[model samples]
Target: MASKESDAVRRHWATNRKAAEENRQDGDQELADHRWAELTTEPADVDYLAVPGRRAQWIVPHGAAADRALLCLHGGGFVGGSQYSHRKLFAHLARAVGVRALVFDYPLAPDHPHPAQVDDAVDTYRWLLDQGIAPEHILFTGDSAGGGLTITTQLRARSVGLPLPAGAMPFSPWVDFEATGASYDENRDRDAFFHRDLVRGLAWIFLGPDGSPRDPFVNPLYGDLTGLGPIYIQVGGDEVLLDDAQQLAAGAEKAGVEVELDVFPEMQHTFQMAAGRAPEADDAIRRMGRFARRVLELETR
Candidate 1:
């Protein structure tokens, strides 16, 4: 049985879903983005700074560890989300994990596609390295398409001989560009914000004319899973992307990588967006924080 708060969240998102559908029909991406951004609670105590060489914001939570960092990617289906929209959520996660988080914007699709997003992610990771943050002290995380980039960026980093981060946390990652996951249909009616058509449309825009859906950089589920560090994935049981998390966990485990996947029942996609307002979201962030602490070996204060 779902908690009362969870049920309330479901109702709220159902309303949001209707609005999103109407917004889409009206060709209002900006309004849809604004509506989604309204779900997050901004942190009043966190310091926001601009990265010198990248289009990124550094969200430094009070009392956070200066030596540890989280490279956070915001999810907007590779088209809409930005650092401002996700900065609060990233700040909450970073505060919980006792680290600063860098949330950056990359070129979105239909204008700049596939390789551009990956390139920006790789460049940001390199910038963090150059800032003297050790690879082992850093973690990567994001939601939706940004979640997928958490993995792809690691792959990109490895291709260029950059050291891998200590761990990753991908919340409701949109990893299957082919949309072959059974959850797409199984949870179709259960999920509020996503439908097959919307996902397909986003994929087309993000992949452009030259990109392949199966390219590991485009979809990390198809990438080689060997040699990556620990990964913790969280997905809503009601989300259409549930199978993406399941498959990625299975594939990573098969390749001898440490992986943990949590499926929250009766939750919507990226429910972590409701952080600070929902118990489930808070629990999920705490779990990720615990995982980050274990991987980074940060002693409890």
Candidate 2:
């Protein structure tokens, strides 16, 4: 049975789904983004600074290490979401891991398509390198579409001869743009915020008419997964994207990469968003923190 708090989260997200559906019907993306920002609770101990040359922010938790960093990407189905909407969630993760985090806004769909987001992510990563952060000390993470970005960015870095990060942590990643996973059908009624129609629409907007859904950069499940560092993936068992996480883990393992995937029963997508308030979320973040510590060689707090 799900905990009471977890049930509360489900109810909360159910309400959010209603609002999101209405917003989708009304085509009010701006309002939807505003509501997302409003729903997140910023941590009191984390400080943020806007990056001068990039659409990114540095989320520095108190006493965090200067040498280690997590480059975080926000999830909004590749159409919505921004730095403001995801700052708090990344801040919580950074705080738990005892490291600074860089959360950035990448180009969205309809206005900007496939390679645009890839270009922006690569640019921001280069900017991080230029700032004197070593590739081995860095980590990457994201939720939903942003989770997919985490994997693609590493591939992009490898393609460009740039050093890859020490590890990656993706939460409920939406990697299969074709929506071919069995979970899409099995979890159809269980998942609150995602469905075939909605993801299909976002896929079209993100991939554009000319792009292929299986393009490794667009759907990382089809990408070469060898040689990337340790990866930790977390997914809600009830999410429609559950199979994306499973397939990614299996693919990475087959490629001889170290990987771990955890699925929380009855949890919703990105349940880590409730960190500090929900026990399940807190436990998930702690696990991620331990993974960061091990991979980045950070001293135990």
Predictions: Cα RMSD each: 2.1, 1.9
Candidate 2 structure quality by residue, lDDT tens digits, 193-235: 7888878888999988798998888887678988999999999
- Model 1: how far is 45 from its true place, Å? 3.0
Off by over 4 Å in 2: 7-9, 19-31
The positional error of residue 293 in candidate 2, measured at the CA in angstroms, is 1.0
> Candidate 2 has what TM-score?
0.94
Per-residue CA lDDT of model 1 for 153-209, tens digit only, reads 999889999999997999899888888888989999998768888788889999999
Off by over 4 Å in 1: 4-33
